[model samples]
Target: MIARKFWVLALGILMIGFSSSVTAEVPEIGQKAPDFRLSTPDGHPVRLSEFTAKGTVVLVVLRGFPGYQCPYCQKQVHDFLLNGDKFAAAGAEVLLVYPGPPADLDQHAKEFLAKQNPLPANVHLVVDPDYAFTNQYGLRWDAPHETAYPSTFLIDGQGAVFFRKVSREHGDRTTAADVLGELERDKAAHAH
Candidate 1:
Protein backbone atom coordinates (compact mmCIF):
# COMPACT_ATOMS: atom_id res chain seq x y z
CA MET A 1 0.00 0.00 0.00
CA ILE A 2 2.55 2.57 1.13
CA ALA A 3 5.01 1.30 -1.45
CA ARG A 4 2.76 2.22 -4.36
CA LYS A 5 2.80 5.94 -3.63
CA PHE A 6 6.56 6.18 -3.29
CA TRP A 7 7.13 4.50 -6.61
CA VAL A 8 4.64 6.79 -8.30
CA LEU A 9 6.69 9.71 -7.04
CA ALA A 10 9.78 8.10 -8.47
CA LEU A 11 8.08 7.42 -11.78
CA GLY A 12 6.91 11.00 -11.97
CA ILE A 13 10.44 12.20 -11.45
CA LEU A 14 11.60 9.81 -14.16
CA MET A 15 8.90 11.00 -16.54
CA ILE A 16 10.03 14.56 -16.08
CA GLY A 17 13.63 13.51 -16.41
CA PHE A 18 12.95 11.72 -19.67
CA SER A 19 10.71 14.40 -21.15
CA SER A 20 12.79 17.41 -20.20
CA SER A 21 15.68 17.28 -22.63
CA VAL A 22 16.43 15.71 -25.99
CA THR A 23 19.42 13.48 -25.50
CA ALA A 24 20.66 10.71 -27.69
CA GLU A 25 19.81 7.23 -26.39
CA VAL A 26 22.18 6.22 -23.64
CA PRO A 27 24.04 2.95 -23.03
CA GLU A 28 21.52 0.17 -23.02
CA ILE A 29 20.98 -2.65 -20.57
CA GLY A 30 23.58 -5.38 -19.92
CA GLN A 31 26.25 -2.67 -20.15
CA LYS A 32 28.33 -1.17 -17.42
CA ALA A 33 26.49 1.70 -15.75
CA PRO A 34 28.45 4.93 -16.13
CA ASP A 35 29.75 6.30 -12.86
CA PHE A 36 30.20 9.77 -11.31
CA ARG A 37 30.53 11.61 -8.02
CA LEU A 38 28.33 14.61 -7.34
CA SER A 39 27.55 17.03 -4.53
CA THR A 40 24.32 16.35 -2.68
CA PRO A 41 22.09 18.83 -0.89
CA ASP A 42 22.47 16.62 2.15
CA GLY A 43 26.02 18.06 2.34
CA HIS A 44 27.53 14.72 1.38
CA PRO A 45 28.71 13.35 -1.94
CA VAL A 46 27.38 10.33 -3.85
CA ARG A 47 29.83 8.47 -6.04
CA LEU A 48 28.30 6.09 -8.59
CA SER A 49 31.12 3.62 -8.87
CA GLU A 50 31.23 3.42 -5.13
CA PHE A 51 27.54 2.58 -4.98
CA THR A 52 27.31 0.24 -7.98
CA ALA A 53 29.97 -1.93 -6.44
CA LYS A 54 28.00 -2.37 -3.25
CA GLY A 55 24.46 -3.54 -4.02
CA THR A 56 21.72 -3.28 -6.60
CA VAL A 57 21.52 0.39 -7.53
CA VAL A 58 18.41 2.15 -8.71
CA LEU A 59 19.30 5.40 -10.44
CA VAL A 60 16.59 8.00 -10.73
CA VAL A 61 17.68 10.78 -13.04
CA LEU A 62 15.85 14.06 -12.43
CA ARG A 63 15.61 17.20 -14.57
CA GLY A 64 16.96 20.00 -12.41
CA PHE A 65 14.99 23.13 -13.16
CA PRO A 66 14.95 25.34 -10.11
CA GLY A 67 13.39 28.02 -12.26
CA TYR A 68 10.10 26.31 -13.12
CA GLN A 69 9.30 24.51 -9.84
CA CYS A 70 7.88 21.31 -11.29
CA PRO A 71 5.09 20.06 -9.11
CA TYR A 72 5.50 16.60 -10.52
CA CYS A 73 9.14 16.58 -9.64
CA GLN A 74 8.27 17.71 -6.15
CA LYS A 75 5.97 14.73 -5.72
CA GLN A 76 8.56 12.28 -6.97
CA VAL A 77 10.95 13.26 -4.23
CA HIS A 78 8.26 12.87 -1.63
CA ASP A 79 7.23 9.47 -2.94
CA PHE A 80 10.68 8.00 -2.70
CA LEU A 81 11.27 9.47 0.72
CA LEU A 82 8.06 7.96 1.93
CA ASN A 83 8.85 4.45 0.78
CA GLY A 84 12.39 4.08 1.99
CA ASP A 85 11.65 0.76 3.62
CA LYS A 86 10.50 -1.02 0.50
CA PHE A 87 13.67 0.02 -1.30
CA ALA A 88 15.88 -1.18 1.51
CA ALA A 89 13.98 -4.42 1.85
CA ALA A 90 14.88 -5.15 -1.74
CA GLY A 91 18.55 -4.43 -1.05
CA ALA A 92 18.55 -1.58 -3.52
CA GLU A 93 20.50 1.63 -3.47
CA VAL A 94 18.74 4.67 -4.91
CA LEU A 95 20.50 7.71 -6.25
CA LEU A 96 18.71 10.78 -7.50
CA VAL A 97 20.85 12.65 -9.99
CA TYR A 98 20.08 16.34 -10.00
CA PRO A 99 21.22 17.27 -13.50
CA GLY A 100 21.57 20.78 -14.87
CA PRO A 101 23.96 23.71 -14.70
CA PRO A 102 26.17 23.60 -11.62
CA ALA A 103 24.71 26.84 -10.33
CA ASP A 104 21.19 25.49 -10.24
CA LEU A 105 22.06 22.16 -8.63
CA ASP A 106 22.14 23.22 -5.01
CA GLN A 107 19.02 25.35 -5.22
CA HIS A 108 16.99 22.63 -6.83
CA ALA A 109 18.19 20.05 -4.36
CA LYS A 110 17.24 22.33 -1.48
CA GLU A 111 13.82 22.96 -2.98
CA PHE A 112 13.26 19.23 -3.48
CA LEU A 113 14.15 18.49 0.10
CA ALA A 114 12.07 21.40 1.32
CA LYS A 115 8.99 20.16 -0.47
CA GLN A 116 9.37 16.67 0.98
CA ASN A 117 10.49 14.94 4.09
CA PRO A 118 14.16 14.15 4.54
CA LEU A 119 15.40 11.47 2.20
CA PRO A 120 15.71 8.09 3.82
CA ALA A 121 19.32 7.23 4.62
CA ASN A 122 19.27 4.76 1.78
CA VAL A 123 18.60 7.36 -0.89
CA HIS A 124 21.37 9.66 -2.05
CA LEU A 125 20.55 12.93 -3.81
CA VAL A 126 23.53 13.72 -5.98
CA VAL A 127 24.22 16.60 -8.32
CA ASP A 128 25.07 15.86 -11.96
CA PRO A 129 27.28 18.97 -12.27
CA ASP A 130 26.76 20.16 -15.84
CA TYR A 131 25.05 16.89 -16.66
CA ALA A 132 28.24 14.87 -16.64
CA PHE A 133 26.55 11.63 -15.59
CA THR A 134 23.52 12.35 -17.78
CA ASN A 135 25.63 12.72 -20.91
CA GLN A 136 27.67 9.63 -20.12
CA TYR A 137 24.47 7.60 -19.88
CA GLY A 138 23.04 9.35 -22.99
CA LEU A 139 19.94 10.44 -21.05
CA ARG A 140 20.26 14.18 -21.53
CA TRP A 141 17.28 16.15 -22.86
CA ASP A 142 18.00 19.05 -25.20
CA ALA A 143 14.49 20.46 -25.56
CA PRO A 144 12.77 23.68 -24.51
CA HIS A 145 10.36 23.82 -21.51
CA GLU A 146 12.37 20.79 -20.45
CA THR A 147 15.91 20.16 -19.36
CA ALA A 148 16.26 16.40 -19.12
CA TYR A 149 13.76 13.61 -19.46
CA PRO A 150 12.97 11.28 -16.59
CA SER A 151 14.67 7.89 -16.65
CA THR A 152 15.26 4.98 -14.31
CA PHE A 153 17.96 2.34 -14.43
CA LEU A 154 18.44 -0.70 -12.25
CA ILE A 155 22.02 -1.89 -12.02
CA ASP A 156 22.96 -5.17 -10.48
CA GLY A 157 25.58 -5.66 -7.79
CA GLN A 158 28.20 -6.31 -10.45
CA GLY A 159 27.50 -2.91 -12.09
CA ALA A 160 25.59 -4.20 -15.07
CA VAL A 161 22.32 -2.54 -16.07
CA PHE A 162 19.47 -5.03 -15.79
CA PHE A 163 16.43 -2.79 -16.22
CA ARG A 164 15.88 0.66 -17.60
CA LYS A 165 12.97 2.90 -18.61
CA VAL A 166 13.14 6.33 -20.17
CA SER A 167 9.94 8.35 -20.17
CA ARG A 168 9.11 10.35 -23.29
CA GLU A 169 6.66 12.69 -21.56
CA HIS A 170 5.31 13.80 -18.16
CA GLY A 171 3.72 10.47 -17.30
CA ASP A 172 4.16 6.72 -17.53
CA ARG A 173 7.27 4.65 -17.03
CA THR A 174 8.84 2.74 -14.12
CA THR A 175 6.91 2.47 -10.87
CA ALA A 176 7.76 1.26 -7.35
CA ALA A 177 5.89 -1.97 -7.82
CA ASP A 178 7.58 -2.52 -11.16
CA VAL A 179 10.96 -2.08 -9.53
CA LEU A 180 10.22 -4.39 -6.61
CA GLY A 181 8.79 -6.91 -9.00
CA GLU A 182 12.00 -6.82 -10.99
CA LEU A 183 14.10 -7.23 -7.90
CA GLU A 184 12.03 -10.13 -6.68
CA ARG A 185 12.08 -11.77 -10.06
CA ASP A 186 15.82 -11.39 -10.31
CA LYS A 187 16.31 -12.67 -6.81
CA ALA A 188 14.16 -15.69 -7.47
CA ALA A 189 16.05 -16.33 -10.65
CA HIS A 190 19.31 -16.12 -8.77
CA ALA A 191 18.07 -18.53 -6.12
CA HIS A 192 17.89 -21.16 -8.78
Candidate 2:
Protein backbone atom coordinates (compact mmCIF):
# COMPACT_ATOMS: atom_id res chain seq x y z
CA MET A 1 0.00 0.00 0.00
CA ILE A 2 2.82 2.42 0.84
CA ALA A 3 4.60 1.80 -2.43
CA ARG A 4 1.39 2.31 -4.37
CA LYS A 5 0.78 5.64 -2.69
CA PHE A 6 4.29 6.81 -3.47
CA TRP A 7 3.86 6.01 -7.17
CA VAL A 8 0.54 7.80 -7.28
CA LEU A 9 1.99 10.92 -5.64
CA ALA A 10 4.88 10.93 -8.05
CA LEU A 11 2.52 10.75 -11.00
CA GLY A 12 0.48 13.64 -9.63
CA ILE A 13 3.55 15.81 -9.26
CA LEU A 14 4.64 14.99 -12.79
CA MET A 15 1.28 15.91 -14.17
CA ILE A 16 1.35 19.26 -12.38
CA GLY A 17 4.78 20.09 -13.71
CA PHE A 18 3.77 19.23 -17.23
CA SER A 19 0.60 21.24 -17.05
CA SER A 20 2.39 24.28 -15.73
CA SER A 21 4.87 24.26 -18.57
CA VAL A 22 2.14 23.81 -21.12
CA THR A 23 0.25 26.84 -19.91
CA ALA A 24 2.79 29.59 -20.51
CA GLU A 25 2.89 30.80 -24.12
CA VAL A 26 6.34 31.93 -25.12
CA PRO A 27 6.23 35.42 -26.57
CA GLU A 28 7.94 34.95 -29.92
CA ILE A 29 10.02 37.55 -31.72
CA GLY A 30 8.50 39.33 -34.75
CA GLN A 31 5.02 38.77 -33.40
CA LYS A 32 2.52 41.33 -32.29
CA ALA A 33 2.78 41.68 -28.53
CA PRO A 34 -0.27 40.71 -26.52
CA ASP A 35 -2.19 43.85 -25.64
CA PHE A 36 -3.15 44.31 -22.00
CA ARG A 37 -4.66 46.90 -19.68
CA LEU A 38 -3.51 46.96 -16.08
CA SER A 39 -3.44 49.55 -13.35
CA THR A 40 -0.52 51.34 -11.77
CA PRO A 41 0.30 51.03 -8.09
CA ASP A 42 -1.78 54.12 -7.38
CA GLY A 43 -4.81 52.78 -9.31
CA HIS A 44 -4.21 54.50 -12.62
CA PRO A 45 -5.18 52.47 -15.67
CA VAL A 46 -2.61 52.10 -18.43
CA ARG A 47 -2.70 50.03 -21.57
CA LEU A 48 0.14 48.64 -23.62
CA SER A 49 -1.38 50.28 -26.70
CA GLU A 50 -0.90 53.73 -25.25
CA PHE A 51 2.83 53.58 -25.78
CA THR A 52 2.72 52.03 -29.24
CA ALA A 53 2.59 55.29 -31.11
CA LYS A 54 4.92 57.37 -28.94
CA GLY A 55 8.13 55.29 -28.95
CA THR A 56 9.70 51.89 -28.49
CA VAL A 57 8.57 50.05 -25.37
CA VAL A 58 10.71 48.06 -22.99
CA LEU A 59 8.23 45.67 -21.44
CA VAL A 60 9.47 44.01 -18.25
CA VAL A 61 7.77 41.07 -16.55
CA LEU A 62 8.71 40.52 -12.92
CA ARG A 63 8.18 37.69 -10.45
CA GLY A 64 6.09 40.07 -8.44
CA PHE A 65 5.32 39.82 -4.72
CA PRO A 66 5.16 36.07 -4.93
CA GLY A 67 5.52 35.02 -1.24
CA TYR A 68 8.16 37.63 -0.64
CA GLN A 69 9.89 40.48 -2.41
CA CYS A 70 12.18 39.08 -5.09
CA PRO A 71 15.70 40.43 -4.69
CA TYR A 72 16.43 39.81 -8.36
CA CYS A 73 13.36 41.75 -9.38
CA GLN A 74 14.42 44.66 -7.20
CA LYS A 75 17.86 44.62 -8.73
CA GLN A 76 16.42 44.51 -12.25
CA VAL A 77 14.23 47.51 -11.50
CA HIS A 78 17.19 49.44 -10.15
CA ASP A 79 19.25 48.54 -13.18
CA PHE A 80 16.62 49.97 -15.49
CA LEU A 81 16.30 53.07 -13.33
CA LEU A 82 20.04 53.61 -13.54
CA ASN A 83 19.84 53.42 -17.32
CA GLY A 84 16.79 55.62 -17.61
CA ASP A 85 18.61 58.25 -19.63
CA LYS A 86 19.96 55.68 -22.00
CA PHE A 87 16.51 54.23 -22.60
CA ALA A 88 15.18 57.70 -23.28
CA ALA A 89 18.02 58.42 -25.67
CA ALA A 90 17.06 55.25 -27.50
CA GLY A 91 13.50 56.53 -27.75
CA ALA A 92 12.16 53.85 -25.44
CA GLU A 93 9.71 53.77 -22.56
CA VAL A 94 9.92 51.13 -19.84
CA LEU A 95 6.76 49.52 -18.51
CA LEU A 96 7.15 47.03 -15.71
CA VAL A 97 4.61 44.40 -14.66
CA TYR A 98 4.19 43.34 -11.03
CA PRO A 99 1.90 40.33 -10.74
CA GLY A 100 0.49 38.18 -7.95
CA PRO A 101 -2.80 36.98 -6.52
CA PRO A 102 -5.74 39.32 -6.90
CA ALA A 103 -6.30 39.99 -3.25
CA ASP A 104 -4.39 43.05 -2.10
CA LEU A 105 -2.25 42.95 -5.24
CA ASP A 106 -2.20 46.71 -5.51
CA GLN A 107 -1.07 46.98 -1.92
CA HIS A 108 1.78 44.59 -2.58
CA ALA A 109 2.79 46.54 -5.66
CA LYS A 110 2.69 49.73 -3.63
CA GLU A 111 5.03 48.22 -1.07
CA PHE A 112 7.31 47.01 -3.81
CA LEU A 113 7.56 50.52 -5.24
CA ALA A 114 8.07 52.16 -1.86
CA LYS A 115 11.65 52.93 -2.69
CA GLN A 116 10.77 54.45 -6.08
CA ASN A 117 8.73 57.41 -4.95
CA PRO A 118 7.71 59.74 -7.77
CA LEU A 119 8.88 57.40 -10.48
CA PRO A 120 10.22 58.94 -13.65
CA ALA A 121 7.70 59.74 -16.36
CA ASN A 122 9.23 57.23 -18.70
CA VAL A 123 9.12 54.48 -16.06
CA HIS A 124 5.65 53.07 -15.43
CA LEU A 125 5.11 50.27 -12.91
CA VAL A 126 1.83 48.44 -13.43
CA VAL A 127 0.12 45.80 -11.31
CA ASP A 128 -1.09 42.50 -12.79
CA PRO A 129 -3.97 41.77 -10.48
CA ASP A 130 -5.04 38.12 -10.29
CA TYR A 131 -2.42 37.21 -12.88
CA ALA A 132 -4.62 38.41 -15.73
CA PHE A 133 -1.80 39.91 -17.72
CA THR A 134 0.52 37.14 -16.59
CA ASN A 135 -1.71 34.44 -18.04
CA GLN A 136 -2.35 36.44 -21.16
CA TYR A 137 1.36 36.64 -21.85
CA GLY A 138 1.90 32.95 -20.98
CA LEU A 139 4.50 33.97 -18.40
CA ARG A 140 2.77 32.70 -15.27
CA TRP A 141 5.39 30.65 -13.42
CA ASP A 142 2.59 28.46 -11.94
CA ALA A 143 4.83 27.13 -9.19
CA PRO A 144 4.80 27.50 -5.45
CA HIS A 145 6.45 30.71 -4.22
CA GLU A 146 6.54 32.09 -7.75
CA THR A 147 4.36 34.44 -9.72
CA ALA A 148 5.74 34.89 -13.25
CA TYR A 149 9.05 34.34 -14.96
CA PRO A 150 11.29 37.32 -15.58
CA SER A 151 10.87 38.35 -19.21
CA THR A 152 11.66 41.39 -21.30
CA PHE A 153 10.47 42.46 -24.71
CA LEU A 154 11.40 45.34 -26.96
CA ILE A 155 8.41 46.48 -28.99
CA ASP A 156 8.64 48.88 -31.91
CA GLY A 157 6.32 51.72 -32.78
CA GLN A 158 4.50 49.42 -35.19
CA GLY A 159 3.57 47.19 -32.20
CA ALA A 160 5.67 44.21 -33.22
CA VAL A 161 8.08 42.66 -30.78
CA PHE A 162 11.59 42.99 -32.13
CA PHE A 163 13.43 41.44 -29.21
CA ARG A 164 12.39 39.07 -26.42
CA LYS A 165 14.12 37.38 -23.50
CA VAL A 166 12.23 35.01 -21.23
CA SER A 167 14.13 33.52 -18.32
CA ARG A 168 12.78 30.30 -16.84
CA GLU A 169 14.49 31.16 -13.60
CA HIS A 170 15.79 34.22 -11.88
CA GLY A 171 19.02 36.05 -12.80
CA ASP A 172 19.06 35.34 -16.53
CA ARG A 173 17.77 38.65 -17.88
CA THR A 174 18.42 41.23 -20.59
CA THR A 175 20.55 44.16 -19.60
CA ALA A 176 19.90 47.82 -20.38
CA ALA A 177 22.83 47.98 -22.77
CA ASP A 178 21.54 44.94 -24.58
CA VAL A 179 18.16 46.58 -25.14
CA LEU A 180 19.79 49.86 -26.13
CA GLY A 181 21.87 48.02 -28.70
CA GLU A 182 18.77 46.42 -30.21
CA LEU A 183 17.05 49.80 -30.43
CA GLU A 184 20.05 51.27 -32.19
CA ARG A 185 20.14 48.41 -34.62
CA ASP A 186 16.44 48.80 -35.33
CA LYS A 187 16.93 52.50 -35.95
CA ALA A 188 19.77 51.83 -38.34
CA ALA A 189 17.72 49.24 -40.21
CA HIS A 190 14.87 51.66 -40.58
CA ALA A 191 17.10 54.44 -41.80
CA HIS A 192 18.45 52.30 -44.61
The TM-score measured for candidate 2 stands at: 0.85
> What residue runs in model 2 are displaced by over 4 Å at the alpha carbon?
1-24
* Highest TM-score scorer: 2
* Residue lDDT tens for model 2, 33-138: 9888999978889999899889799999999888788989998898888888888878889999999887888888888888977777799999987888888888
RMSD in angstroms between candidate 1 and the native structure over all alpha carbons: 15.1
In candidate 2, the residue pairs with backbone N, CA or C atoms under 3 Å apart (3 or more residues apart, or in different chains) clash, namely 25-138
Candidate 1 matches the true fold with a TM-score of: 0.81
Please list the C-alpha lDDT of all candidates, in the order they appear. 0.77, 0.88
User: What TM-score does each of the candidates earn?
Assistant: 0.81, 0.85
